[model samples]
Target: MSRESFDLDIRIDPERQRVAKQRAREGRRLMLLELGVAAALVLGFLASGASRRLKAALLGAGLASPWLLVGAYLGLVLVGYALAMAPLGWWSGYVRAHHYGLSTQTLRLWLADEAKSLALSLVFGIAAGEVIYWLLRTYPDTWWIWGSTFLAAASVLLGFVAPVLILPLFNTLTPLDDEELVARIRRLAERTGRRVAGVYTIDLSARTTAANAMFMGLGRTQRIALGDTLYSQYTPDEIETIVAHELGHQVHHDLYQGLALQTALLVGALYLAHLFLRWGVARFGFAGPGDVAALPLVALAVGLFSLVTMPLANAHSRWRERLADRFSLQATGNGAALARAMTRLANQNLSEIDPPRWAVWLLYSHPPLAERIALGSEAPA
Candidate 1:
């Protein structure tokens, strides 16, 4: 397609844009609602003396070891939290997606996925809680520093393993059989002075129609993964542009940059949590920072900290996304194709071309669709 042939105005469907806006709005509403519910639950647990009672009951049951006590407390807390949140999870994850005609998952499949997610969360959450409480007990005054460091290390470790260990649990990933396309992508990587382990297609169509492409893993594990919906629907040039964008993330080391950002945020949040714990000790008569009953305070602090900092993190993310978009245009030298691809993606993925400015400021992690399309249209080939 010629540069002049791609008309930005004509490519957008008005009805689709309307649906996109509604979906986006509702999605954000659901997120905020979930957060509110979580905060309320934590506060209720503390206010009602439920957390204290639970900890006391466990201790009275002859759970003598601190490790065992922490484990049991976290397990019960996590289970209770999960049970409380399950209704909202169903509404947001399953019902809402189905209502929007976005989800292909049946109730059974959705439940199965939720089960997997809950199991993973329990394992990780309990493990992290144990380590954290241990640190609190051992280093009451400076546990935040050590805790943040451990959390930072864990984040990076997850980054390296998630693509291989975690992702495969949810979706089947197999090598893309399109030999010609694979070669084209390899050449694209080569042109950027990089190599990929392989090109794979993920089973996105099984769950949702949202098209996406990503560079997965780090170092020797690095590979390109194209959503099946993307591979089946988009043209080679369009896919090339999308893959180029993912490559930009790799080339710019955005993953490492993100980890660094996360480490900073963790330190800040943990410090805030420490302060909250100290206040809980004074106000709520908690034993100390190591008190299991004060866990809710730690959660409330960390959650509030994350909620407050979300906009700043999102702004940083938007900057990276803009850089990636620029890289895609420069690397592919197919601005027209990129524009067309974004147009199709907006429609297919139900993205609002020009979202409200407030949403852009507070929620968006990428430049709005209209801006990306314009960038592609204006790029010099």
Candidate 2:
């Protein structure tokens, strides 16, 4: 059906719409399934007394140091969860994506990507587990506060380093070769009174057909990445509108604001986890809050807290996205271009034009397409 906005007419392909709805349903189900699996793993470990037995076994194996014991226990649990979840990950990320004509990678390439992701997870997971356990032992009275602060700082550090250190592990990134396009983007950033270090194109086409662009990093590390898929398809004007929205993030200092919000939430979640750890020492027969056996309780507490608070986080994110949209219009003074860009994005990305209200509350980090289009129409020319 052809949908009319004040400045543009956009058509939603009926078949694509049906496919998009189907994909959305499957994606939700997969999310629920992943959550269910995680909850079950943690709960089963606690209820079955498996955590206690595993810790005992590790101690018996002469891992007498608390740090070593905790590290080993966490490593085993991480491997077990990954093994259990691997099949589902493959299905959702590979099989289902391919079925929907979204994925472009061969199975081998997909598996390689998964392997790299798992390796990164295991490395970080084990390290974080070690630090967290150390904090639990050393700062038993206020580990939550200390741990949350450390994690927040670590998150900021990661943001600074990821565009350089971490992202290259997954895909190739090169300075965008188009001189005209680069100049245009740099000019857009200047218009917003900010400057990006560089404009780069990411090899997203190596993995999927979906189009995207992002403004990432902090300080000198700050840069913009346009997916090759988007670069190949979108016109310069449409691309500029997208870049303006990203520059909006920079101009508004949304990155720092978002980190602050995240830090606040992390404190809340860890505080909840700390309480659960104390309660678990009695309820689950753990020796103390520092006992490695009580790790499952921590996981359960943190996961549940995140699930409950996701809506609030998403609501804040949507607000920021709206501000960026308005910024894009104001900076570019071209609402029609934004509207057209959004129309293309909807079709190319298989975005659902009119998702349900509940989904928006729970899941959406940006306003729905119709709302964005209406906002564009109402923007000053």
Candidate 3:
């Protein structure tokens, strides 16, 4: 046989090929199962008179006293957290990550991390709920509108605070001190007219194998954070590309835009929630707002709202991600490097190369790797 023909005969081991295909199938199956279960839960809530019961409970509790209403809400949140932790926290978050070779955390460490996150979430959730309740009382005629506005303001406040206050609870963050890499990144930031206050690195590898880089904070506190795994695994050029992409988010004001968009969405959702709560209470024979028995009603309403809005939110996020990818390519002038970085990150995370369209539409916050790479390559060098 000719040398050319022999070279073309490269083959994959049959067993390895089978395993690869099986893994792909399994990933798709799991994705579908997750979405399906979420949808079923949302539907069940709507059908089961859950919303009405919760509204009645909330109303009764609120009428009795503001403190009573707050207590009832906290109780509901604790119960929901307990239910979610068993499956999502214990089994899915811990067991599945370990089973898939993605996690390096011990069970004790994982539990500790989960507890911290739960506490933070509870605090934030309660604060936000109290604000919403106050707004509802203040503007009984337009509770939804006013409530949404309050929620949006709270969300932005949280965003600004998360990197500085909340994030440190789970992982150690240290200022990036590698002189050579810092010099290169600072140079890049200067060229893009972005100030480089400092670079930070997170010990994400302590928990999961996922590789990521992010631009956090706003104004003087604004900084970039790179996962340790990213620094260790990727080349300098690849890291530059990733950093540049993150910087793009800052340059384009994506963070602020995202906050605004989310606020608008939440306002709409609150208005819809108000409408639905009234109907739900009537249909489900709820006991009036503050009743503990009405917790399920509230859960079902919120769950359904979130589920229905997933596709829209995912699409918006994907658009921002694509824009960032393009900006990165332009900033770094290295499409191939960015592509390589993306592929490496995906492989490290065991991400599916071509997830089902519906799944991607519903769940993905970033464009698929292939599309990102293609856009990067097609951009002017």
Candidate 4:
């Protein structure tokens, strides 16, 4: 939001720092609020003996038809989750962006987007849950392996289609009109030996001031996209550094690596879910994992697993991110450009330049800005 603060020197803006600290505080609150709400829903459902009633209600609602049953169950679950998450979603997803002067959305527009998201999630989640529950019902003993494999495939499929299908639902994607930057990007791609399909710009200024670029899609959909915010707020050299960094991700096959690692994590998480479900259904006197009523328990299992694994995942991510930084430096052979770009990006995004060590260990998926800046200034081999 403060384009005037784009300075190469590491000068601190007191006002921006104040807002960033406030944002951080509020962000922590949002995270804790979300976690508490999720846990409360899970525990409250379990404790209030509501699960059985919901299951029975679904049975009656779906008594005459199979589609009716799945529809009723899925509808109830999705709507319930949406209702529970709405307040926090507004506070974090909508209000916070406005508070930070990052958002350009009206409340009505934001709510409409939220509704569309809920609808999309409901459709896909129900479809997937139906098959997953069917697997659990048919192969209780070995469902974890099959379910995980299915999920891994689904994840890949989502990534493949997301750029082409889902992205357009929220924002308009258009070609960047800056020929000079586009040419530089093409040259960078050629230097990296990657044939990027095209470079496009997403209309991010309509929604937020956050600057971002990424290499997404697979095969035909593979291309680089820069948020419009980036171009408006950054110089050609800075954008080039971001392009090189993202291209480094593609050259290193980080996407596939990330997918594979996530799949591995899913397999383990699902296996643990199986164990938890087995113990839970017996102890809590609930229906089997296939029952819609027990979905909350499933969520709990996966959620807890992710929480426990957060630090490890963050560490791996930060390591790979550093590798990407080093790759960018090597490819560009302009450490000063990279460092200055990194600095401007941090200032533009109002990123916490140097977060607490413990917070970085627990939740950060990328290395601290200071560390990344240092990488650009690393001595040549």
Higher-lDDT candidate among 1 and 4? Answer: 1
Question: After superposing candidate 1, which stretches have Cα over 4 Å from the reference?
Answer: 1-10
What TM-score, to 2 decimals, does candidate 3 have? 0.83
Cα lDDT of model 1 overall?
0.87
User: lDDT tens string, model 3, 1-381?
Assistant: 001111112222344334444665766566567657655655565476564455456776555676566656565756564564356446567777777777888988987877777777677767766766565556645767777777777777777787888788887778976777788888888888856546788888898877888888766667789999777777777888998888888888888888877887786666666666666556656544333344445556666677788788889989998888888888889887777776666566666655668768977898876677566556666
- Per-residue alpha-carbon lDDT of model 1 for 229-348, expressed as tens digits? 788777788888998998898889888888899899999999999999988888987888999889999999999998889889999999999999989888899998888889888988
- Residue-level lDDT tens digits of model 2 in 1-381: 111233245555677877787788879889999999878888998999999999999999999998789878988888888888899998998998888788999999988887888888888888888888899998987999999998899899999998889999988888888877778877776776655557788989988999899889998888778888887777777778888888888888888999999999999999999999888799989989889899988898889999999999999999999999999998888887888787777787888877889999999999998788777767777
What lDDT would each prediction earn against the true structure? 0.87, 0.85, 0.70, 0.80
Rank by lDDT, descending? 1, 2, 4, 3
Where is model 2 poorest over a 10-residue stretch in terms of lDDT? Answer: 1-10
lDDT of 2: 0.85
Order of models, best TM-score first: 1, 2, 4, 3
Candidate 2, which segments miss by more than 4 Å at Cα?
1-10
